[model samples]
Target: MLGIKEIEAIIPHRHPFLLIDCVEELEPGVRAVGYKCVTFHEDFFRGHFPQEPVMPGVLIIEALAQVGAVSILSVEENKGKVAYFGGINSAKFRRKVVPGDRLRLECEIIKQKGPVGIGRATATVDGKVAVTAELTFMIG
Candidate 1:
């Protein structure tokens, strides 16, 4: 398990923009499972909807990407590098994620060649999928 500090060591993301709160499971260069504790205080909630706070779907995809980053960046040779989004394919938003939801992020590197790779990613709340995507990344 990795807290925010250790996650920061692998990925370059800070508070407010750093959507992931903790990593529950990680396999360097392969997969990672992380969490985001959604709260009413989220900055996006202010503009996303004041009366009804819903975590943005794009941000949910970003959270999935961040988890995938931890998996790839933790590799010894890739340490200190950045994983830039190459593309996002087949992204789908299935359910609404609101404040007080503990969003679970799961990502597995399903394909890789050289510095480019693809991950099958998913985000869930209470075991119900909220979002999913095939994310491509370029390690630089």
Candidate 2:
């Protein structure tokens, strides 16, 4: 398992932008499973909705990408590098993610060629899927 500090070492996100809290499982350059503890204090809640706050779908995808980043950047050769989003494909939001949700994020490297790769990513809440996407990234 990896915490925010370890995750910070692998990816270039911080504070409000760093969506993941802990990584429960990781296979360097292959796959990762992580968690995001949603809370009412999130800044987005103020504008996303005043009465009924919903975790934005784009942020869910970003959380999944961060997990994918951990999987790729943890590899020895990719250390100190950054993973940039090349594209997002087949992104779907199945349910609304709200405060107090513990989002489970998982990603697997489905394809790769040189510095570019594709990840099959998903985010779930209480075993129910909230979002899924195929993320393309480039290691820099």
Candidate 3:
């Protein structure tokens, strides 16, 4: 299990930009679980929609990717390597996420060869899936 402080050691995100709040689990090259709290004060909310603010779908995927990055970086073999968003496939937004919602982000490693890795990720709010995606990253 990894907390916010431990997670920060692996990723550089911080403040309103740091989408991940905690890592509940880390299975090295296998899987990871991360958490994030969405709030109304987020800068993007103002532009995404002022009246009926809905969390942007891209940011949700970004949060999931951050979780995947944490999982990759925490592995001792991958230390000092950076994970870059290589591509996204099959990404979909299922439900609306708003302020005060706690997002549970999970990622599982599908395959990895050399610097390229692929994973499946999902974000859930209140036990209901909010977003899902197939993400690829270059971790080297």
Candidate 4:
């Protein structure tokens, strides 16, 4: 399990911007499980839908990326390297995520070659997948 202190060391995100609440499991560059709590006060909820707020799909992907970041950087060789989103493919949003939902993101590293990494991730809300994607990143 990774606490906030450990997470803060790997990613540059902060409160309101930090999507991952805690990393429940981590296997270096292999796999990770992270959590996020959706609240009505989320910044994007204000303008996303004034009357009927739905968490943005992009943010769901971002949450996945955050978990992927921690997993990738956990490798001792890549410590302190910057991880940037290189591309996204086959992304699907299956359900709407709103306030009061607790999101769990599961990410598995598909490949890590040199400074380039690829992963598959899924974000679940209430035990159902809300988003899934093939994410690529450049680490340097």
Task: Report every candidate's CA lDDT.
Answer: 0.96, 0.96, 0.89, 0.92
Candidate 3, residues 1-140, lDDT tens digits: the string is 67777877887777677788889888877789989888888899998899999989999999999899988887898876778999999998999999999999999989998889999999999999999999999975
TM-score of each: 0.99, 0.99, 0.94, 0.96
Q: Once model 4 is optimally superposed onto the true structure by TM-score, how far is the C-alpha of residue 96 displaced, in angstroms?
A: 0.4
Off by over 4 Å in 2: none
Residue 41 of candidate 2: its Cα lDDT? 97
Which pairs of residues have clashing backbones in candidate 4? none
The global Cα lDDT (0 to 1) of model 1 is 0.96
> Taking the tens digit of each residue's C-alpha lDDT, what string does model 2 give over 20-117?
99999999999999999999999999999989999999999999999999999999999999999999999999999999999999999999999999
10-107: candidate 1 lDDT, tens digit per residue: 99999878989999999999999999999988889999988888888999999999999999999999999999999999999999999999999999
Between prediction 2 and prediction 4, the one with superior lDDT is 2
Candidate 1's error at 128, in angstroms? 0.4
lDDT of 4 by residue, 12-129 (tens): 8888778988999999999999999899999999999989999999999999999999999889988988789999999999999999999999999998889998999999987998
